[model samples]
Target: MKFKDYYQALGLERGASEADIKKAYRKLAHQYHPDVSKDPQGEEKFKALAEAYATLKDPEKRAAYDNLGQRSSGEQFTPPPDWQQRYKTDAAGFDDVDLADIFAAFSQAGGRQRQDMPRPGQDYEIAAWVTLEQIFRGGEIEVGAELPEYDQNGLPHRVAHVFKITIPNGAADGQRLRLAGQGGHGVNGGRAGDLYVVLAVQPHPLYRVSGRDLYLDLPLAPWEAVLGGNIEIPTLAGPVALNIKPGTLAGQKLRLAKRGLGNRDGSTGALYAVVRIDVPNQVSPREQVLYEQLAANSTFQPRAHFATGAGA
Candidate 1:
């Protein structure tokens, strides 16, 4: 097998921190994973990513591979002298992982230990967005996922297929949902892998969701604000008329019951509809003359407070 430069492929510096490596991997994985990505070489790139991760995720093997340099590009990977003595030691500070699993491939290729290598099926990621209604109702979202074909030895042949997904309700943005046994094919009778769906909720044009409560910008007519009447307000469910008290002003908020998002603690939040009176364009000649006559009787000044701060 031809050796790949894991760091370059991952867009990382040799001196990159572990957190940096993890962040880079997450980004590249999202870009190359077959399910969400339509890149022509997504499958190929994903497999290469899996291979690179399999190496970089292991601190010992990563240290060794980082030192390999040009010697790795040859058909077979023959480690330089003292490679085993150099990296054969178990890693410190790494818990819950076995170093043997990562280096087994190299060993099977005659680097160190002669153990059978069973590569893990690759993992996949997808990004999805949901509407507030969908978030409340919870339903299946069909997405196209393509997985690469694998060789007998478990390396990828760069072939894939599209698959769908069913998303649940109340899913927040940046959430990841996993589908088991849906990743790259396994090798040597190993088990198939898994797929992940990443959530990306698009912002609503009128409503801003905070936790379970939703805030809406409700446009009201000037007469509606001044005279108080039932005005149609938009909600996640649909449009409903809300009673606006007489002499209502801009920037006032009305709280509606049972209209916010569902919370995890078995309670729902209230939706706040903020009021903003809109002025009419091109008034009728008679109405314009009436307004001019009404101005003489009206002593109200909306910007009376402006002069208080004018000289300060």
Candidate 2:
């Protein structure tokens, strides 16, 4: 038989502690697990890692394997005569038998104990699109997701599930809401994993969001911008009156406090009414006459800066 160095297979020293062994196994297992790894040799490497872990993780099996003494890997060797006596096994023709098979026999005789251990299910994250109104009102929204489910034989397959998830008041875009015991099914009575719902706020036609603040284009007539007046505007909650200041420039933002998205801390974000000055495309004859008179009498030089060096 050839000697197999279990420690070297797991990339660990012979004196590695139990915790070190478990940590190393987990890291290597994740890297080489055939389902997720792209390496061509991942399956074989994973099997080797599993075999090594199965032996080293057990106190009695590790002691028995260590008694074989240190030797170069793959070197032709034979176990000492006392090895069979210690393990209370009588076997003929040890040659050509794999090292994994040797330890597997011990596990099998122990009633396949590891298979009965509880294993937690996998966690999942899915996205759910929400509306600004939903965030403001804080209510339940239906979400559908395709998640992996394990069958009776422990084979994983995709399954669609619908969940009624609550939209938190003031929930921001890309915020994650956790639902416990809603992920993949656990094995052997283990706790099921959690499901994370990532909120993707749907784009609104009239409003833009930043953090919890709301912004809307507030179109104002030329007279309203120049003379200042109160106008009605829409908010997520309802319509509210907003005051416009005289000489308000285009693109100026008018803030309305406590009129935006609700916050988790019982506060609310500001609503910004962006000013947009508008003018009538056509004018009545009487209106044109008034405009012509104002143009003739007015001394307001709107383009005065164009002639001045200040424009340069």
Q: Show how many residue pairs clash in every candidate, following the order shown.
A: 2, 0
TM-score of 2: 0.58
Please state the error at residue 63 of candidate 1 in Å: 19
Task: Tell me which residue pairs clash in candidate 1.
Answer: 138-169, 145-163
- All models: lDDT? 0.68, 0.80
TM-score for each prediction?
Answer: 0.60, 0.58
- What lDDT score is found at residue 56 in candidate 1? 80
| lDDT tens digits by residue: candidate 1, 1-312 | 244567777887777778888888899999999788999589688867766777888786787677766432323454455533344422221122222233434444334443445657667676666776777776777666555553343223333455565555446777788888887655546677788887777888778988788999888887789999877888878888889999998999899988888765657788999888898888999989988988988998878778786632
Give the per-residue lDDT of model 2 (tens digit) for 35-66. 78999689689988988999999997898789
Candidate 2 yields a Cα-based lDDT of 0.80
Candidate 2, RMSD to the unseen true structure = 14.1
lDDT of 1: 0.68
